[model samples]
Target chain A: MEFLNQNSLYIVLIITVICWFGIFGYLLSLDKKIKKLEEKINKE
Target chain B: MVFKIILGIGLTLVIIAGIALPMVSNPSSFFELPVVPGLEDKARIIFFHVPTAWVCVIAFITSLIYGIQYLRTKEILYDIKSVTAAGLGFLFCILATVTGAIWSKFTWGAFWNWDPRQTSIFVLLLIYGAYFALRSSIEVEEKRASLSAVYSIIAGLTVPFFIFIIPRIVSSLHPDPIINPQGKIHMNPTMLVIFLSSLTGFTAVYYWMFNLRVRFSKLLYQQQMKEQE
Candidate 1:
């Protein structure tokens, strides 16, 4: 119980990091797609 | 491109400041900051919950502005921006609601309480849903853009009422985290710093996503024009 109490915020921190990176990763992939589309349009 | 790189660096700094610094804060009571009753450690959710809710409103307001621009100029680009902003607003609205519900579950002992805050956000989701439905139901480009712009404008009017007015005027278990009755934030300095950093970081995230959607949609519109020519 003591361990759980102390580590609760740590767990929250880990989860927050995961959520941040997850969203950032999605945005990165979308950026790649947008770049590809930009390239395609330029070629045309 | 530089904007994206800058935003990424800023967000990394935000995560470090928010999580790392807070964790290292004197566990007993960081800088004499009173531990919120019943919230304890779970209170950290404030960083996530508030920012998501704030960005949701920002996106809706952006949609409203672009919607008005579309009506004035009849530019398809403005209409595209308006819809993209609304789409992103809806996404963030759902995120805020879900995160708030989870926080409520841990703090309030129920996943939902039908409290004024929760109810207002529910109404907001419904309004956004209707806007999307209104957009899709029309097949004609001019009709769709004009009609949805009108719908977005009308819907935007209710956003302030639901998000700001309703929650405050009615009684609820949800504490006013941002401001107090005295109109001042009652927060520790370190906590406030972290919260503000997270707020800026999340706002940047919203802009990054919103910019990507607008650019992508613009590309699609140009492609269609080319094909037609």
Candidate 2:
């Protein structure tokens, strides 16, 4: 807590990193869903 | 599979290094970034912001290529690819503009001052906005594809002029571009490495997104055809 208070930019960086990971994870899931849909359509 | 893993890990490392690296006036070691006189810690925006613009340019050029290919081959797949690329370009263009605006607020003391660089990108946004508008207004598939292809080619021709030439012609508050008139990078070696790495990582991310979009678009087109049949 003390270190974070002293170095506030790191806090922003941490938040940004978390947000990026969240977005990346969302994209990964979306890609998997698209792939599954493609397979289903092909099978039909 | 390997490329995806590499891209994920590589971008994570880039973000860490770009944000966490210490900036010093005199960078005596490899890890320390030389402080750009006016930018200071704010200089870090280069890693993320510039890449968005670079990706935007790359996406636009790709759209242009596929547009030309569509015109030559008259294939629906090429049209799909062309439009997908343009959509991605527009998205990144917006990212670039927003990121630039935020950075400008800190550096230039305003969100927008109508700097030459800002003006040019605004014009580009309008041009591509019209491209999408033209695309959606046409109901006929073939007509929409060919007309948009021609429009994309013309819009792409203007890209180089707007992104590269106009900014240089008029003096502005914006910093000299990475590839300046002197044709030399002014960054310290450590900064350059991270900057180049960030560029590569962002480009890979763009490619991944482009692939996913094109695949999804193709699937949608197939479904539409089946429904019509």
Candidate 3:
């Protein structure tokens, strides 16, 4: 707990990076899903 | 596919650099000007907070344009686009509000201030939320599309008033950074670079999210059409 308080800035930096990377990851996965959907729809 | 991948990689890099640069850079006391007095280093929140609010307004404007297009053409696709844009707009609006609330809690020593800017943004959130509720409550597809498009148009028109005009018209603790006549940013050069980079990075993120949502909806529509066949 004391470690968290003293290093709040680094903690924030880590959290921010994680959150942003998570968003990008979600978008990347969604892009893949859309590609597959497009392929499926095109086949019909 | 390649374009989007490249864009994704580029945007991720820019956003990471934006966030990292601000955190790592030294705070300057040049000209005895501080971005936000009393907040000091914590004023770095400005990079994230301001850009999210800007993106929110951009999303609302995009929604408004699509709403108008839907009304003009009465095309279902236009309506779909409008609703999708509104959905993203509302999410970013809520983001802005939440980030602002957190900043306020730390800076002002309270979470909810009822300041003019705070009140206006809260109202904007409620308005956007109501737009979603209104859409979900309607059962008929055509009616939902048409009515919600009209509602979105009206609500979207009011966003500028809520976000920009009203807050400035009344006193508020939130800094009126853009409205300065000179249009000059007052900050250390490094801070300015990070601020501008964050703004660009956020805009990129907004478009990327918007495109993802729109394409996902298009896929769903395709699925729906096949089901009706």
Task: Give each prediction's DockQ, rounded to 2 decimals.
Answer: 0.57, 0.65, 0.54
RMSD, every candidate, angstroms: 2.9, 2.0, 3.6
lDDT of 3 by residue, A1-44 (tens): 99999777667777877777788788888878888988888888
- Per-residue accuracy of model 1 over B113-200 as CA lDDT, tens digit each: 8999999999999999999988889999999999999999999999999999988899867777665554323567767876887888
Candidate 3, residue B92: lDDT: 84
Candidate 2 residue lDDT tens string, B105-210: 9999999999999999999999999999999999999999999999999999999999889998998777764756453226888878888988998898889899
Alpha-carbon local distance difference test for all models: 0.83, 0.89, 0.78
Sort by lDDT, top down from the best: 2, 1, 3
Chain A TM value for model 3: 0.87
lDDT for model 2, please: 0.89
Better of 1 and 2 by TM-score: 2
Q: Whole-model lDDT, candidate 1?
A: 0.83
**TM-score, one value per model:** 0.89, 0.95, 0.87
- The deviation in Å at residue B209 for candidate 1 is 0.5
